[model samples]
Target: MTNEDFTTFPIDAVSQERLAAQGLRLGLVDTSDAAAFDAWLRADLRGFHQGDPSEKVLKEQREGLAYRRTTGVWDETVDEPVVPVATVNSWPANLTVPGGRTVPAWAISSVTVAPTHRRRGVARAMLESELRTAAALGLPLAMLTVSESSIYGRYGFAPAALAADLVIDTKRARWTGPVPGGNVHFIPNERFVDEVAGVHERYRLSSPGELPVWPLRWQQLAGLTGDDEARKRGLRTLRYADEQGETRGVAIFKIDGGDADFTKHTLHLEHLLAETDDAYAALWRFVLEMDLVSEVRAGLRSVDEPLLWQIADFRGVKAEVQEHQYLRVLDVPVTLESRSYFSDGAITLGVTDDLGFATGVWRVEVANGAATVTETTDAPELTLTVNQLSSVLLGGVRPSTLLRASGSPVPDGMDALFASDRTPWLSVWY
Candidate 1:
């Protein structure tokens, strides 16, 4: 169907049932069409909760858009810095509508489906559309903190990176190093827009799998927008720089009360970007040393985080590791070639994928960070489902690990398989 049709057509329950009766599949939303979709959204919102959303709520969405724009987290970046094309529900920069100018990215605020179309793949459609759009735009990955992990996996989304929490106890934290000297100067949120953007850009380029923060994400973080509510709820952002007037890293945290004795002071680290070991240590040390902050929590950390090695008391830090992200090599040869590999020798990989993304057996040749795939029905070296392939694609899981897993085929040069730059990390969730 045309974009106009997709946007304008009402997909109410009865309509969805009608489509089901005819056996039509879920399709893409026509993002180019604004009118029909806006109307549909208004109708959808009104019917979303079986009542009308007050002007206050609409005002919230708009303010949230402004807040999100400044934080560089929003997918779309506008001239005045508006929310990008693909976004789920977003919060205002502050609690008040039209409250501030800058918007920043924060948590996954909320999601909604128009009433005329419930359970008809609207959410999924929106999600895929957003991710694909981000990928096409070469934006840093999109992310959302999810309450339910299982829901987003189908679309290839993964868990948050940079894992930590405000729950960490500084008393237990053995101080590491003479804290690097840097004046903690608070600038007007707007003044640091360029500085914050520059720091994040440097971080993103170096971080192989880190998410990109649009200007809006920065806006939201700075609390420039009057609309953002979450920041009004007490989200705080900070920046650190060295004696050379160079911005080294940025942190977003929130202080929350905890236990009776401990008082439950918590700081959720949204982002910590560092170029040098000293930078990484300094940034973390600053957080640990925050006065009156009793606990710290961070999430979505790299498997080989330097914090583990830096800590004098290793046992003092608690880490619960889980699978972060799953990636499918859309174009096996290109995907492999895009990443670095440890081995210079060429090995033939007999690959099998049950997932429709890549199916049938194919031969993958790797050498010197270069890969080529050729269709072959011959006896393969590795025969595994798409999930296993996805897991191993990042080089995070060793080839040996895959072979150990049941149903994972070990082709001849199994050792040489997935010999790319340690495991690939999907550090960001989109």
Candidate 2:
């Protein structure tokens, strides 16, 4: 660990003092210290209702997570500081926005408050501290993929991207899309984990709301490490190579056939990534046309997935859309300027933020697919809460939808002005 690893947030003081009154110590974890890191890891797992990790797993995770800014609330009064009653961690991630522009984002995750510590304000303290620290660091945005949807709106976060959980009836979905000239081959798990970043990098640039994934998550997806290794023992991975012999796509999946029905096996797709449209069509057809797999289940897919139209029967593809990534805007001007717009227009936007990070009126002008924003005293043609503005920021959720929900007078042309050619999607949870 370097000096950067030892850095602590100044925002911790408020939580520290508040928790101290109740005999709790809120502080950062010295990740280089093995014992402390292990205890925190165990508490985090228990908080999520998972089994205590083995020592081997603990060591592996401690090394993997050493670089993150980890914080926890310790109650030394009970059992004297072995484990914390609450845990949270954060790291910087590049958030891809509309028009292929990327902005630095503070990614928060691994938030947990033990059941025994309910209603103690531990979660509130940690969350507030995180937001304050992120803004202090000069970050323009704060993002998190939520476990419970209802917990974050009060904090000025709204769902900016929608993900689809899909179950395709392979027997009825025939290959109707173009037959791309690419060969699909079975690849080893180790190779896919090492090579996936390149494929994902290409895909992420054009897909708004995608975040840079951690190597640990890639290992989990490739079945390299997990508590349930036995369940992943049968994992199979596939890669697609274009005619020019480049690895353009990958799919990690497994077949479950314990139902005692020989022809009704289910193929579950753990992860699928394709860099090219050709690769996408080929890999999907390979999965849908697999032998003995009557059904396939995949999650965290784009809401506007092309597979929906690739199948012959539209009803064969059953996709359920769910809110995935919730984004909170910290700087309205920075956010509006980073992304490109669809229609050229000028309008005043008024943002109402209780947190006070993004409460202001700004005139947004769009021309030649770029936007320029500046503070203005002009009246707003449309007014939105901080969360509401965040929802439509990426254009995945239409501004008109929220405008209708608010029953507020919004200018008509603003809806088309904020539209995106591609839908926003987060490939994996941070």
Candidate 3:
């Protein structure tokens, strides 16, 4: 990292040189400066099809985005040299792995390149700069929830966790799961932030590939961050209390539809978090038994959901599996040792990385709920690309399926060895 020539984040010499060769300037955004920050923010929203930001939104966003390490790329020849053509935002987050442990991972987001700057290697330079920034921070992994799936594989990133979008016909579905001993109470929307005490943190640690939710994300979901329309449509919030009078879960939703046909309402779930099975069952039961809604649609849920068996009619519940979060491993030794392995044995594996951050054959030995990985010169029993290796890091991706997709033979016991007790599911998109 070099800072003599740049203003904000220490310049990545590699990206600086790459873009400089193509007649562009690579620099960082000083978020404290209002003009630069607003320009970057507008360009980001424009990339996602949102129009320019108003003064009200800008005032709110000035505080909301102050914590991010923002970067951008500039084209001086354009009419507006003050506004960047490309933008990237990053921060450090705790990535929960298997066995209730967490490792610090770099989270990258708000990546956008101007349409006028296509085919100029701008995206590649920006992505490489992000990876280098992560490596410089000594982080073991980098993660992002992608909007475009096709652009990241070449950069050595692959989906490590999967989620489901569920649509259930409330008329046909009946709750046959455990009769909850808990009672659900409707609370005012403003009290949600104070009431949700450690529920997401506890639930996050219990699952692999989950990350901590920031304060801004919570504010947006609770309709506190200037979401006037969500309030206008009637946002309902519920809190569940168990038989022992313990608060265990929270849900936020809105039942929205046209008034002409009132029976065809759809319950759009915004957020749902339950710390216990009883709380989960009770919350879901409450959703499924709503009086007005005929259909319930929930997105970013676990692929292996317990609700599958809870419904009386399987035909009513529809779940579509989709990859949600992607991971890129930087330090193989630190990452491999952070999570506990299920099977106790030794496996010599080879990892080939184009970025050269993690390209080596290592001997992985697991025993007594711990793992020991060391470099080995011996031939690898199984060979996997860098992304393929990242896919198996969370223990959600089946190695056999990946190998078969590439027309390669599968190795025995590999699936069971990397299988996790709880599935890796990320409910929040960072």
Candidate 4:
């Protein structure tokens, strides 16, 4: 990758020209300079608050709980100083993908380049720089919802998942017959963290496409990340456990209001994990029953989520479809073994690498819940590239689909091997 000329310090016109002539300079935006970048974001994006109390209030009261508990893509990487010229700063909202299970990936926020620094490749540099940084960080993948899809493909990022948003009226959400079961209670957000984990883990282990939430991610969700507004909003984690004391599901949300004397009760569900349809119905019923919350907003839900269908009055909900996270295979063997595959026995296959995840052939042995992957140059039955491998890895994009695509290699028995149980469906994005 060619280094860009842009640096932390302001560049002169002549220096800018020289840098532009050579190529753009790309670099990380140091954390020490976060304030500067924040300022740039506020100015560039009109209507954005200048870190005011109102924004804090909004965060504290409405958005803070979700940001604190919910894990989305915005992080230190997005702040990288080197800007690319092609950024749309579009801030596309929630997106959905239907692969057996519905997936919710929301990209509701973003910040781009300064006007003076525009046209010089700030956004492009920033975008590519973040991809490289994410790769180096060992993150399995990176994703963003975009109005301009053309911009991200150049950096080896692809649309791996999608989601849709829905607005429903409570009066329309007819509560069906309730299954007498787990008791629901209002608990402190921090106290309910474990319950949330328990429920989410149940789903995560069974779900093909969900990523494991790290400790720091939970901390962030609980408003424990030193974001003051989140604390003030009284953000609490809500959980429902069975009589045996096992947590079935949890929802993170708070009460909200606007200036127009509207009492808006929004539930920004950070994570809703339930194994059964009954558990899901009960949990959502609990939320809708909250006394004052008029409107409920839940983020990161799968498209065609059963909750909507479960509600008798489906029209009460309004939804918008959006893009969420994107995935790329960095290390083929490691990637294959990271998640559980359904193969019962061992098989020798010749794997191909078009995106350069790995080269030559590999022998992968799967037994029980374990797998052994080794490099092998010997002739084999199947051959496929990194992209194709990634598609098959999730089970959403079939091996047959990859073979059908132009330039993809054909392999015998590959379809049967991949079609074992069900195609993988990642319910969440990193």
Best by TM-score, which number? Answer: 2
Ranking by TM-score: 2, 3, 1, 4
Cα-based lDDT at residue 67, candidate 1:
31
lDDT of 2 by residue, 57-155 (tens): 797789878888999888876664689999999987888889898877889988998888878788888888888788778778899999889888988
Give the Cα lDDT of each candidate.
0.48, 0.86, 0.85, 0.50
Cα lDDT of model 1 by residue, 143-201, tens digit: 45454557666754433222332235566766665567664444555655666677755
**lDDT (10s digit) by residue, model 3, range 1-430:** 2232222447689999999998899888888999889999888888777778787767677788778888889999999888889988888888988889888888999888988897778989999998988887787889999997898899999999999999999888888998788899998777776556367877789989889887667766777666376573488888898888777898989888848788789999887889999999999999998887899999998988898899989899898988888999988888989998888777898889999988999998888768899999999999889899889888999988898998977878788777788899898888
Model 1 TM-score, 2 decimals: 0.66
Q: Which ten residues in a row have the lowest lDDT in candidate 2?
A: 1-10
Q: Of the candidates numbered 2 and 4, which has the greater lDDT value?
A: 2
- Candidate 3's clash total is 0
Could you tell which candidate, 1 or 4, scores higher by lDDT? 4
Q: Lowest-lDDT window of 10 residues in candidate 1?
A: 94-103
Off by over 4 Å in 3: 1-9, 230-233, 258-260
Work out the TM-score per prediction.
0.66, 0.96, 0.94, 0.58
**What is the descending lDDT order?**
2, 3, 4, 1
Worst 10 residues of 4 by lDDT: 65-74
TM-score of 3: 0.94
